[model samples]
Target: METTNEFERYQKAKKQVEDIKGFYGHLASYVLVMGLLIFINLRYTPQYLWFVWSMLGWGIGLFFHAMKVFNWFPFFNKEWEEKKIKQYMEEEKKTNKFE
Candidate 1:
């Protein structure tokens, strides 16, 4: 009972989800790097500037992570992908009609 259009939509959605997951995984690794920096700063210099940099980097990385996890990050949300998919589908529809 599943039409080709339905299957395509499903695949598109699945790929989008995977892309978001990739983003989260990347951000998590970035956070880990920042954690290492924090550790080094604490043991070596104990400077407030290092702490500040850690906080800033963590904030930016966490924001992206949350966006990926929650599927809503201002300009880079599900809606944006949806729009792109829709555009592709529209073009496909036109090509299919011609065929």
Candidate 2:
């Protein structure tokens, strides 16, 4: 049981590290792509300045991704939601009722 618990902890840590790494990778890509887009927009069509659209669109997605990856979202999260569900299920079982 102890070993199993340790393995679970290790797995969770590994998953979290992967998520952080993935977010950094996304950030890097966003930087590179947006830089290119800005350069193009400035060079070819400075009057139109269309890169802002892409910037805002992808930025909103990046913000949400950061929120989820870093747990900045205060409302809830998958792990907390699952734990709550399990807790409520156990409580329902104890009461011999569910709603």
Candidate 3:
């Protein structure tokens, strides 16, 4: 039993680490690509700054990605789902008892 719990914890930790790593990788790619875009836009068309649009769009996506990885919205996660399911089950049990 102890070993099983330890294994589960290990898996959870591993998954969390992977999530963090994935976020960092995404950030790195964004930085590199945006840097290139900045150079291209400034060098070729100094009057038209179009990189801002791409940055805004991709930044929004990245922000959402970070939120999911960091669990900023806890209500949408696995633990919350499990808790809600159990709560409903308990309510059903109480109703059945009365019946």
* Top model number, lDDT: 3
Q: Enumerate residue pairs that collide in model 3.
A: none
Best by TM-score: 3
Q: Which ten residues in a row have the lowest lDDT in candidate 1?
A: 46-55
TM-score of 1: 0.55
Best-to-worst TM-score order:
3, 2, 1
The models' CA-based lDDT, in order, is 0.78, 0.94, 0.95
TM-score per model over all chains: 0.55, 0.84, 0.87
Q: Residues 1-99, candidate 1, lDDT per residue (tens digit)? A: 579889999998898788778877777787688778878888898855476666786788778676666666666666888998999999999999988
lDDT for 47 (candidate 3) = 100
How many pairs collide in each candidate, listed in order?
0, 0, 0
Higher-scoring candidate on TM-score, 2 or 3: 3
Tens digits of per-residue lDDT, candidate 3, 1-99, equal 999999999999999999999999999999999999999999999899999999999999999999989999858888999999999999999999988
